[model samples]
Target: MLRGAYLILAGTVIALPLTPEGLADGPWWPAPAVTGTSSGERYHAVEPRLADIIERREKAWKAAAAQDYDRLQHRSARLNRLLDSAIGVLVEGEATRARRQIRDLEDDLRTQTGELARLRTALVNAPASGCADSGGSLVQDVKCALMPDARTSLQADIRAVERRVAELRAERTRLLSDLTGSLQALGIALPASDLEALLVLVSADRLIDTYAAYRSLAQVNAALIRAAEAADGDIEVLKRYYGFHVVLVEICLHLHEAFLEEIEGKWLPRLAVLRSEAEAAGQQARRLLAREDAPELRARLSANVDANGLSIQAADLYAEHLRDQARTATERWAGLYRRHQVALNTYRTVALQGDVLSVMRQSNRGFAELVRLELPPLRDFESTALRDAVAELSERLRLSKL
Candidate 1:
């Protein structure tokens, strides 16, 4: 009876057709209506500019969506061929794989270098004499005297690690040189140093960095298949989906850029001034403590100095914490933007030739849903007091949609 019931439930689910509600259930639900508040009111003030941006993005997306699916398919195929050729050149003679190994070895070398430095410092600071017996056991005093010997052992370990690190660096450098030569032979102009190039790319934008680090040609091929499948073989739908994500990415990027501008232009400078002020206050307190001889007056001045120092320290720490928080928020949004881009691009490629409905029912369902979902962080950021103008603009955009 239990087996029969389970079979019946499975049959029911299988019989149910995919609907908008089903798709919405996964991730792409419509944005919630923005509620009114003091913050929201302030956001409304900049609604016109935000509306203009959204309208312009929507128009561009509509135009792109109108392209022929067949043409897109051809373009996707060409891109894939080019990408595979590049990967072929990279993996020739196992050069690509070697580069990856070299990267790992370089990381190990960095860790070992830091360890060696620390060990050297410990050796330099090792006590010259044994610990004095201050109501301690004799065994403890003997162990304390062995500190210098322990330091010597650490120094030896450091030397061994240093040698290993040097060997790894040499191997990595040689592999990198070989890889560079191979790519150049293929008419691909890659940076002389793969690691340094990766660092520069990653620093510019985390999302682009992920795409650039696809690891293998096969992964890139799979990604294109997934993208085409997501759009259900419809060029128009794929274009709209791509445009929507582009808008989201733009908004997220703009928000982060604006926040960074405020931080660098205002908050950071203010923090620096505060830090300097705190240092000055500390120096003043130390001098006062040294020079002042009056009992009651000295006591009052010392108390004032301590209080001032504590306040400044607290303020500096709080500012630093805010800066860290902003950075983390920006990184989170950047990562999400990249994921959206990947999903859209994959849909664009797959829409050219795949079984749209079949693929959608399988792997592409979640991808479709994700494209429509409003980013919570972005929504919350829009509602903040600091972004009153932006919030106002966003609210206008929402109302215009209604």
Candidate 2:
């Protein structure tokens, strides 16, 4: 559904070829000052009103930049603390902790497994029930007693036990996987005999596979942590990257709101006026055509009326297209802003809790990948105008270390 919506929006953009001036005439265009040319040569082309807003907000921008940097520093400090805690967990008998956890999970699994077996046995032995009528006169009340639905009850009980067993088994698998990975990460390998005893209920091949997968995941986790730590060390870089991203999101949001306001306040009113004019012109043209007498003059009048009608139709189409564009752009910007906000909030929370590993997990793989790929040099994101602006701003901030 989302893909189809985006395709439709892309088609709209491709189909409509409005001029920059036309777009700017309404609130559809982004603030010129915010998207000023890179060489600083085209700054004069910016609208006076937008330029004034940018100039007035210069101090605010600097303050925001500083605040962003401070926030980055705070996050870095928190991450450092988290890293220390993670290292502590890794160093302080992680294997022993994993073994204990695995043992507990195994015990729970055993209990659940036994419960499942008992439930299944009871289900098989449960009595079937049937309703029967005792022979009686047609007018007399029949004394019929229905047996309890023991089969249904037993089946329900079996299902409940099965679900519990499945949950316990899954938990046990997770615990074993974690323990295996932690031990492998620490370069500790249990002997085959020990593994067999520890995972007595599990199959040999499955244990081997789990051990291998755990080792691979442990390596990945270690590499991600190392990268995160390295990035944390360069607090200025992180600030610049994140600050630029935030600034872009802010600009997009501002532009979206401005476009919506323009649609409501300016465009809609213009459309309404155009609609009224078109209706009035159509009525006038119809009356004139009805009274026309001269051939050449009538033809000229008819052509003029047709041209007017066509102009109105074109105007209506253009206005509708603009409306569609505005709606699509608003949704796109909102979605982008939401994704960035979620990433930012999650980072802050997880960093505070010193759970960088949690952030690196598959559950947060998207965010982790973004951090790894985006929080680097500005040169990588020079494709689009907005990205180029972000790259330039990031470089400038990094140079000033502000």
Candidate 3:
């Protein structure tokens, strides 16, 4: 029942719909990617982030294969330090300076624009934020970057983002509630369980990238305050949040590779067992049905096997679908590196993470019909001998998830 992507978060299974179609309902902003050149050209340059991605990919995948998910996630924060140092060494100083030149110029323009707006507001009560509203590609980015009091504007923007995130949570809760209600209506009657909470929190930190999208703005503000050698509480706050974003980016990049092994080493095997058991049950039911002459008995036996059989197929398809999702995300990542690689987007790619979550959220609607189908009560089965055994098997499959 997946429309997008999903994952096993700290042993908790989550349904992530990160699909293009789902993005229509969300905000999507992507950083522009630059193309590469031949020998010492654009695309060929060594990117520290790319190298770190390879390293983290290798290490993280090893851990995930061993089923150490908690450790895998906790250690991601350390990679931020490792990555920063790596950039200082792997990437050329001149290239970085050159890249920042354009970014700096944009910052300057925004600063001047904000200043003019401030003057206008002082002379004539033109809306204090009106100038900021007209500031950049994204209004909040500009406001947080240059307009008004740094602390006030930044905090307000942060609050606004928090509100949006809250709304997303509410919407998700309702979606899950509706899903359960729909399932009950369809006769599955899913039990109230912890999986619903696990599923809801699956995308909890999704908006970290959105905060990082304000990276330039926040950084510029922090840098100015630092230059003045003045104390700013928001300075530490901004640093902590930005640092957190870096950790997440590193983790996500590695996950694009490591999580695939998680699927192979853990998830697929569970599904294989389910499918195998279901297949056997189908065989047994078929044999029993063939020997029975009552039409009613025949229908119940056939329906149980057929319904449960479809659940197994749906689960299997979802498992394979997750593998494909990780592979696709990896391919997109390969675009960023130098080897065999296409030159890809700037660091601002992190800002566009909401869309990535949207992509993960996409999945086949059929998965909506419980991947492990809740078979009708076993008492309805014709044969008394195999009914208990088959019922137990059905329950086991029903509880299984990727």
TM-score of each: 0.33, 0.33, 0.31
lDDT of each: 0.40, 0.40, 0.37
User: Which lDDT tens digits does candidate 1 get at residues 303-383?
Assistant: 867666665554444355446545665675455445434544544454555433343333322221112211112112212
Off by over 4 Å in 1: 1-51, 54-242, 343-402
Off by over 4 Å in 2: 1-22, 25-244, 350-402
The 10 consecutive residues of candidate 1 with the worst lDDT sum are 15-24
lDDT of 2 by residue, 222-291 (tens): 3333444467545443332233223323333333443455455555566556556766887787788889
Q: lDDT tens string, model 3, 358-378?
A: 211221122433233232221
- Candidate 1 local accuracy as lDDT? 0.40
Q: What is the lDDT of candidate 2?
A: 0.40
Model 2: clashing residue pairs?
82-354
Candidate topping TM-score:
2
